[model samples]
Target chain A: MATINDVAKRANVGRGTVSRVINNEPFVSEETRKKVLKAIEELNYHPSSFARGLASQNSYTIGVIMDNTMDKVYANPFIYEVFRGVEKSVYEGGYNLLLLGKNTYQNGKLAVERVLQGKMVDGLILQEQIIDSEYFKNIEQYNIPIVSIGKLENRDDISWIDIDNHMAGYMAAEYLYSRGYKKIAFEGVELEKIFARERYEGYKEFIGSKGLSVMEANELLQNIEGVICLDNIYAYKILQRCKKINKKVPEEIGIITFDNYPLAEYLQPSVTNIEIDLFQLGLCAGSEMLNKLRNRNCEVNRIRIPVSVNIRETTR
Target chain B: MATINDVAKRANVGRGTVSRVINNEPFVSEETRKKVLKAIEELNYHPSSFARGLASQNSYTIGVIMDNTMDKVYANPFIYEVFRGVEKSVYEGGYNLLLLGKNTYQNGKLAVERVLQGKMVDGLILQEQIIDSEYFKNIEQYNIPIVSIGKLENRDDISWIDIDNHMAGYMAAEYLYSRGYKKIAFEGVELEKIFARERYEGYKEFIGSKGLSVMEANELLQNIEGVICLDNIYAYKILQRCKKINKKVPEEIGIITFDNYPLAEYLQPSVTNIEIDLFQLGLCAGSEMLNKLRNRNCEVNRIRIPVSVNIRETTR
Candidate 1:
């Protein structure tokens, strides 16, 4: 119900300036823009959304698709920090986020297509498991910008934000090896996810180069001492099995994994692993998204968040 | 762009039947209604939102306002699971969720009020912290139905869903005693929060029953051999300080805390703590909100989620 005049007064700006800002006209300085936004937010102004939509042809909304829904792994502070960064950037850019859960049934295409067809969002942030190249083709037809958090095989043109999975795996293996761990094992999902594959490759190559044959079980999961996991759940399962085999972690074998989920530390001996800077990933994604929304050209793309090895009771 | 006719065809139902189902008119059987809704969701048919808005005077949307934007303890799997449960129930009931982050600025009332006045939502799910009471009052004026995940000290009449914090605290003390931990400490935020204060009282009373006195650290902290913490960060800091003073965990002292954050498992020896059923909380909140929105005479409020102990490597 608040008019432009009230907003202008509260923002300490001229009425015409407020009008221009409301119209989203160019040439307004960043300081003036901040003032207008602050006043608008403070006054609880709801601009005629219908009118703004007709004039600007933009919705100022982004759709975020995440694979995990309210599980313990998503409870990690790292993921939340990234979300905070994403939220902060979006608020500053005057965009709101709509979260869509990943439909394991592959039926969520309805929601995705609806948002696209209705123009409900200006962009999409995909955080699901890595998909094949064909899925990218399907998404590309929508013509809206998308930024994926996980790598998609055989696709490089699209924007993505991820962590260096290969290096993280290498680091885990090297760290375990340096601590005099000879027998180790890797445990993760059987899925063909890009992250999992890359980390597996890294672990394999590093161990192979060290003149040691990677052991394996004669059946089921043959020939593995140290364990590399796809997620914390699988890692926990591996731990339970290790106890059955009388293999104590970091004593007879070592363990490591990606996506330092919250429950990792609570496990006995505490799983020492690498930590991804998810906040930086979200910040980078949001920045690129804002640029895409404003039609501004930016060189940012395919950013990889760094990782750190969190040494705990699991290793030593 | 898909119409009711498209949904009807996909569902193999008549157009008239689809119309009746969409409008919630009489004569449709429960079985038929389920089929129609499944088809509608599958087709992503947003059935006459404009018409529904005009006729029913309600938007099929609910706003969720959450506190603690930082990943800290708030990122517990319990919180996310609750949200997931809420999401599933609401979407099935034909409602979309709008997530609003707690704006930390000094003047956040305006933003909170805007959600109500702007007609962006028909109801609200408020997750409040101790410091956000002023903003809470501003939103309460709209008199729209609200269900909170946590309780407000001053507002007794509002509907809320919460875990039994007092019982959880009592249980933490009991767990330590059963484990032969005689001396105990309590660490959490300043005693302004109800959860912290209540939990501490529970611990004190239970320990006192066993004829044990809690050690005091001058004025800074209540020093004991074991600890029941409010959050992981405080638990980490407390444990670090305890180590500096030559107090070893589980060996010299035992520890328990409320809210098992993801990183709790990754910490050395992991952390033994109380786990609230967050998913059930969300489901209960969603179910209650739906009931309130559907019926005018429904006066039921105040639901409590159960909590459980996640026994990990922290205790003997």
Candidate 2:
């Protein structure tokens, strides 16, 4: 088989010049590059990736690490959209995506150990679901560039891109309140997740500002005239519960939720929802990670994706 | 800053001994292994993945190449479930997944070139949507083991795992036909896709066996009492169209579809669907690829995943 030496010998250039041409490194003269290319084409030489990696110290691959278990990631379509966005940017940036499942790590330390030991990826895009985890702290030792999908509390070392969860919640609540529904119920908040908690806080802040007390879901369903759900899936359940209780939607009770999933439009009373652009969020995260990978001093380290409310039949 | 030589010197062993210990290769004595481990820990030596990869000639990562575009993959929840299954098995097997999107390849040759030149992954799990593509033909040159998610026609070089689309379609037709529905309509058949075409053939074969004529979706909706949809998304569309035409589901018209997605039960008149175990399919593909990667001679090359029907409100 043909080797780099063979190509260099044929081109009458040094091995370094051949390596530069093969790696597409700048500074090589056009005359020398043309000779190297012709020699490479004639010799049918293909550079080994390991050799390339050893030369550049870059894998041209990004690791997408999800904190949530596989089941949880697949359960929510929002994650898929974000992944699609990340996939698009990664592909456009000339990098492959390495999906590291939750099981790949015991904790943050193990995850960092695996990445460092394997030199598996050039950079990482982490999906931080839990707020209090020590993942980011442990990852600091590696000095590898990382971009997170969700914000980390009390940590500025890593870059992140996230939807404005608080604003999403506030919009849902404010829309329902403006529809004259005094009693509103908030559902599906897992305080462990930073985003969910932020959304919940936004809802409470909106209700507090209006001088309207936030009611429990059960209480609101029986007495209140409206409910702001956490997401489209939650909205579907609320709609089902309303049917069981013989209450008419948008008449006796109005509804609004987050995530304008297809089900929101397909439901009997199509749900009014906060359209969080998960795809754009993924794209932002990918771009941030790419920037960090390409440039050590990336000026814009954090990004907040905006959300919009899509009014539907649930709000009448 | 610590290197393998430092660990080898500390352990009182040769560099090859330390290399074998780090690579986890067989033939190294347990006592020597323990000594090397202690030295490695004491020195805090981190092995360069490129150097390790060169020694072992394995990346410990598998590439998942999707034939269809990212949008199509994300549009259907089934793909996510399949990916979850693959992710689970891949994680358990101690390998990372590299997602290669459609845009990665300009053509079959370029796709093969990227995989070969980069040495990006040890093996590949290809999602083949079309049978007539030159992808498999070109991939034959690379001698790289591959496991396809769907079956391919006229090619036995690579292994594949797929649900029995013909059976799935037949079962749907049989169930709806038994319920006293004649002149049933089959929705969403793209002849280019093997599974879709298989399903269409199954439906046609069933209709032919019963000496009945298949009606168009428009005609069936106007006259027939039942319809067999292509999948859950198609079923949802059918339901929407029914509502638009003032036709009540199940009461005035019955429906059954493929892929019992989560929203199937949530629909007003819940859809009866063919429940395909996509996660299991993914697991099978992952396992098949792993076996091929680990063993040159695998017992089972072709696997057909089973599918069942879930009767719901749409059928009742």
Question: Which candidate number maximizes DockQ?
Answer: 2
lDDT of each residue in A1-316, candidate 1, tens digit only:
6767899999999987887887789989999999999999888776533334434556666777655534543443455456656755665566666655554221243445544555556788776452444544565676787777766555666677778887777777777778876555556635476787777766777788797655433223334556666666566666666766777766666666666665446445567777777767777777778777677454547777777888766666
lDDT of 1 by residue, B1-316 (tens): 6777899998888988998997789999999989999998898686544344434557666766655455543344456566666765665565666656677221333344544564657888877573256766677777788887776666666678888787787888889888987777666635787777777777777878889875533233334557777877666666666666776777767777787665556445578888777768887888788888888458858776777788876677
| TM-score of each candidate's B chain against the true B chain | 0.78, 0.77
The prediction achieving the highest lDDT against the true structure is 2
User: For all the predictions, what are the DockQ values?
Assistant: 0.15, 0.35
Mind giving the per-residue lDDT tens digits that candidate 2 earns over B40-135? 989877777677666677777788865445453335556666777786677667666877655444223354456556576788787766333665
What TM-score would each prediction reach against the true structure?
A: 0.66, 0.79
- Candidate 1 docking DockQ: 0.15
lDDT of each: 0.67, 0.76
Q: What is the TM-score of chain A alone in each candidate?
A: 0.74, 0.79
Q: Output the worst ten-in-a-row residue range by lDDT, candidate 2 chain A.
A: A103-112
